[model samples]
Target chain A: MTSETPAALAKAAERPRPALSMSTGRAGDRIFAGLSRGSGLVILAIMAAIAVFLVWKAIPALQDDKANFLTSQEWNPDGAPAKFGIAQLVFGTLMTSVLALVMAVPVAVGIALFITYYAPRRLAGVMAYLVDLLAAVPSIVYGLWGLNFLVTKMTGVSGFLNSYFGWIPLFGGSETGGRTILTAAIVLAIMILPIISAITREVFVQVPHAHVEAALALGATRWEMIRMSVLPFGRSGMVSAAMLGLGRALGETIAVAMVLSTTAGIDWHILKDGGNTFAANIANTFAMSGPTGRSALIASGLVLFVITLLVNVGARAVVARRKEFS
Target chain B: MAKRIEVSGLHAYYGGTHAIEDISMTIEPRSVTAFIGPSGCGKSTFLRTLNRMHEVIPGARVEGKVMLDDEDLYDSSVDPVAVRRVVGMVFQRPNPFPTMSIYDNVAAGLKLNGVRGKRRLDEIVEESLRGANLWNEVKDRLGKPGAGLSGGQQQRLCIARAIAVQPQVLLMDEPCSALDPISTLAIEDLIGKLKSQYTIVIVTHNMQQAARVSDRTAFFNIAGTGKPGKLIEIDDTSKIFTNPEQKGTEDYITGRFG
Candidate 1:
């Protein structure tokens, strides 16, 4: 239609344009909706892309027969013919993660409870901040610190245990054995402690004041209120917090490798010698690997990916059940 | 049957802010007492003091004597938990431990006091729900979540949970404020029934509620900013509403000033 035609003129009226004076919803609201939809779509697309890429890269390793991607323990990517299995890597990974969680959960929950329930108000904020700072420290820094400082401390502790509980298979190793799975687990605990503790402290603080007051008014001691009101209210947070920390521990590489001094073998004694986690096995052996070795490493990585997926799924389930903090 | 709660020259503060000024009143056993005033007039604060709940807040402190049956509640040797076991509180909002079910909510108080035999717990839960007038509504659904109840029902559930231990006194802070008229009436009727067996203390912004439920009415008012609250007048509910001695109490009850 010609620019001056009635059809063109009506089309001009039909064109979308921003109205300055006439208003229904404020302009800010429309902009907010636009921003939210844009960001949401971007996150969705990114996550989908990552999942596709991970699955694509993982297929080759899974398909390899000698890789024993799911079952066997022999992870010799550098064997004469380059046949490898994930069995030992899986065992090592589970051992290290469970050990780390065993050490961290109680301490994390206790620290959180102490800060929220018992610490003097004037001091509690500063203590909470210090715990938060732990999470800010980089994973590499934790590795360095674990090697330089924590290893020696754990060595001393390992010595005492060797003397006392050495009869047990796990602790039978020489106390001087500095690099072992036990050491790696303790290092992992320190690394993830802040994550669990911070979430738990926040959860404890979010317990409704009225619930707390109701408990208190009923003649509950401070500890009783914590047991009755605070802990139960924060239970889901505590569980998810632990799962979040587990996610971190699952894929950690640099720190675990730095401290573990891992060897390629299947040994039930965690304190005897260093055993490699899947992430550490990949990081430690990737440079020296041939094609089969790399394939085997990729196979282990696939397993690590599955573990993290399961952990994150569990965390989401817990988060769904938890009440809002406010 | 005539237990007494005596508060004498009581003062309480949050940090440096005076929340409750010097106030004294005696509550009779099985009698309903209402603390009424404008918002921030220390009614809730004073109610908290009776149960030693004020101390639970960080920086909250109280001074002076709070005697129940002539025993000082704030005495250093007194156990706060023991004190709470005897006096229970219902909050402004219904909080039924969202994680727990209807059965568990009533049993919580008993469990806290170390009463754990299953038969005994079941008996107490049934009796408490009946006392709160909520047994019939939730009897079949004791396994359901307490949070899923209607507002009034949730509140009665909370009340049942509190009274499960058979406390000597009950403290309520605006127990009906969040409820509708029908729910409010139900709770009010429950309160009347409750006071015959347990001493009851309540705080409310609605003057008509104070008039309707309380056996004795206390009129409290703010004296000055940053100062403790003062008791303007306290007497029989009818006398306080119709023939108060203080002009401030009359002005307040008449809707001239709050």
Candidate 2:
């Protein structure tokens, strides 16, 4: 169209421009989307395959069982007709992990707060690095240290608790053996402290500066400011971090097996020896097990997996209900 | 209960860098005073020093005499937390406690100060919400999350939260800068009402806002980049707007310079 011709200009504007020849960007996007979908499907496939294999192997052993798998506090999977139950192991797993969480979470949160708010500026970085280093220490090393070193030191402490706090059923055992569920829980607590603390630190750090200022401006003490601003903002994140720590506590094998004096009976006494966990049982028994015993261990592993999954889902749901704040 | 502020030889620093230098002024009780300055001139920093909020930052500190009546706020035995309780502050952006209900957000300060009776908390929360002009909109939804409110409403909620503690002096650091014009007007009106009961100090980049809301105005200036900010002039808002005593104040008010 000529430059001065208004009608011709309008017509030209209405016409679509020619398309570019290259379509690589669109092709790249499609390929990337497909790759991500494929990866997700691969994870699903692996999980399903594991579930199916566990069920396939476990059914025959379960069918031959002479006792109730959910109630009987005995493990004789290699016995004639395979007589075993996960009741005791399940109790041990839950009790130890819950105790560990009860012990570690508060301390972890405190350490996180100290690092984020209370520590000298130069020291905070060094302290955070040390906690990270603690997390990276091998579980096997922890197992060795927990069994060799802590078990001995804990005897005196266990004796003290039994003397002063033994009125509670959990700590009401006559015996004061340090090789007990409490010891295992204590070790697990130390092992998981860094994981929970580090995540909580990040969450605390992410609390908006404005909210903290709001609390401080309203005459909040440092601890009170943390309570009003940092704690609420990081609650969901802390729950998720605790859940992750719980997952590790549940699935932990070498350290729990090494520290816990395994017993097949369900006992409420936390101070005395006698407890078993799904992962610890599997780890301790797998080496000497026959085919059916192996399948039984696999079944126990399946239950542990489901329990961890349920814990994660439950934590996620709790976090989701508080999503409005986020 | 309102209290007048008398600041003298105030110097604030962030690490080694001086932020606000040798600022001194008297803020009358039951009136609004506005501090107007360009970006990075530390008007906000000086405002924070009145209540000891500046030291919350790592390596940030203030050296000065901030006299609230006869009490020296920076005295060795004076707790910063108590100073803050007496001199409340509102921030540039609305920062309602995200996890709390509107009711809980308003009651947060009282709870911190050990007010536990449910009846007392309810009374103070209602009164403070009314004081911030937020009661009518949020009264029916007291259980709703404070963060669920609109930006303007959230800012008012923050104000309600501050006033719930019954501070004598209220500091607002560009409280309406993030709001739309209509919301800004609403807050300006609220400030005018609030001035009758509290000694109010506000920092604003908008010179017209200072003229519109403040009874007295202080102009802050920096010589160059990285230089500490200085208070150039303080006078009646009307006189400062029409005919300033200092050339820098006149230049800034006339938009010839910052």
Candidate 3:
């Protein structure tokens, strides 16, 4: 019986195995792989196409301009001798986005921490739902609200800052109306808050259960546990979230256009009226612009696109560097 | 600074579900007491209750009394954080803070207790790492992340982190269950060495492990699914393994049934 069993086992081992094939033998597998690879290439193609189009459309206005397209503060592209530059637009975009980031990141992180750690379970669920719902509110609606409600209410805030903090160069302007860069920045901050908090909350929630328990087991108070484990683990995530918020603020058009009374020059005094970002300028001028003006706006749009891309790439690099340690 | 543990008429629950019921035991100072049970027996839950870690889970609660050398651990005046400081825990899996260096991992608990000065932290971190039998392997790369270590090394690093706070008791909830055989042997040896200075309670599924390390052994069992687990018997390790007074303990020891 043993000899017969050994012969049968040897015969079984010699049989050709159909399951060992690793190739994509089935039609479904080949089609799915091809489709996924095609989708990835399509994204790359679309990105390149947009860049090519922007550069192609922008060159004519840039060549015809009398002033330096980069350094000149003038924005009269349709004149007999066209004049335009991105300096003022660049300054406004950076100032408002950076200001918004400074104002929003702390409050967003605070709200995230409170929802994840401090709130009761039911309240946390409700709060998280509300924050997500806030993100779904349309940008145009935010613009309308900023123009009618927020701008009117912000005069007192602008006055207070001018009264007490006017010594700081950024606040030294004499403008007392609500339609200043500060008001626009405040609206931008509010616009980006939901997204920043949502992402920060997800990062906080993804902090490993073991790490949290390790802190608590070591006798750490709740606050200490958060500081030691939660914050350090979520640091890179929070930075990326803030970077994403910055990207949104930089490109935000309608709200900034509605809030800020436009001017074509750089102003460090954020409390003063009159600043124009690339997106706001494009939105405000696109309808009235002649062909040269439209091309000029497209040129500025290209720069804004590049800046946002750089910001996102920088965020990815920061996240990747921290990934090694974690 | 080992302290005796006296648990009396203890019951634990998870929301509406009773987990462990009426477990009473005395664990001597400077010795190891092991809890041996099948899956779903609530042995881990009972061990967590010793340090108030059970209540950390939302809706989980405990009833009755646990005294650490005449001090009621569950007393309203006693903060759970303070209780945990005195009774440190090692989990089933290795959990060194992934963001921290090996040196910082060992110093973590000490930092929480407000220990300052670089020299002092360095001294204690080295001492604790040596105590966990991990100093030699990691001494040269102390600045490296703790998560970069092997599973066994990470577990020992967690042990070092726990003991750095100078706890009176150490509770291990199946500390070596996730480890390879070699790592398991190393942890068992470390557990044997640790019992000279800290009261230790270990929950293990391995019967031979229970026989090898424990001074006293406990047998826990449940009647059925959804039923609260109960302690079957507790006695000297030799007696429990050879001639248990309870029928269920004997059946479990002899592999008749869980």
DockQ of each: 0.61, 0.81, 0.82
lDDT of 1 at A202: 90
lDDT digits (tens) for residues A1-326 of candidate 2: 46679988889999987678856588889999999999999999999998899888888888888999889898999998689999998999999999999999999999999999999988999999999999999999999998999889888888998999999878787888878899999889988999999999999999999889989999999889989989988988899889989988988889999998897798898988769999999999999999889888888888888999999898788678767556
Ranked by lDDT, top first: 3, 2, 1
User: What's the distance in Å from true for residue A150, model 1?
Assistant: 3.9
Best by DockQ: 3
Over A143-171, each residue of candidate 3 has an lDDT whose tens digit, in order, gives 89988998888888788988999999888
- CAPRI-style grade of the A/B interface in model 2: high
Q: After superposition, how far is residue B192 of candidate 1 from its true place, in Å?
A: 2.2
lDDT of all predictions: 0.85, 0.92, 0.93
Local accuracy of candidate 3 as per-residue lDDT tens digits, B1-258? 999999999999999999999999999999999999889999999999999999989999999999999999999999999999999999999999888999999999998889999999999999999999999999999999998999999999999999999999999999999999999999999999999999999999999999999999999999999999999999999999999999999999899994
DockQ (0 to 1) for model 2: 0.81
lDDT of 1 by residue, A1-326 (tens): 35669877889999989768778777899899999999999999987886676677656554554545556666665666445677677788888888899999999999999998889876888999999998888888989988898787877777788888889887776544667788889888988899999999998988888778767766677888888789888888999999999999888899998988877777777766668888888888889987666766665676687789899999998898653533
RMSD of each: 7.9, 4.6, 3.7
Candidate number that wins on TM-score, 2 or 3: 3
Window of ten residues with lowest summed lDDT in model 3 chain A: A16-25
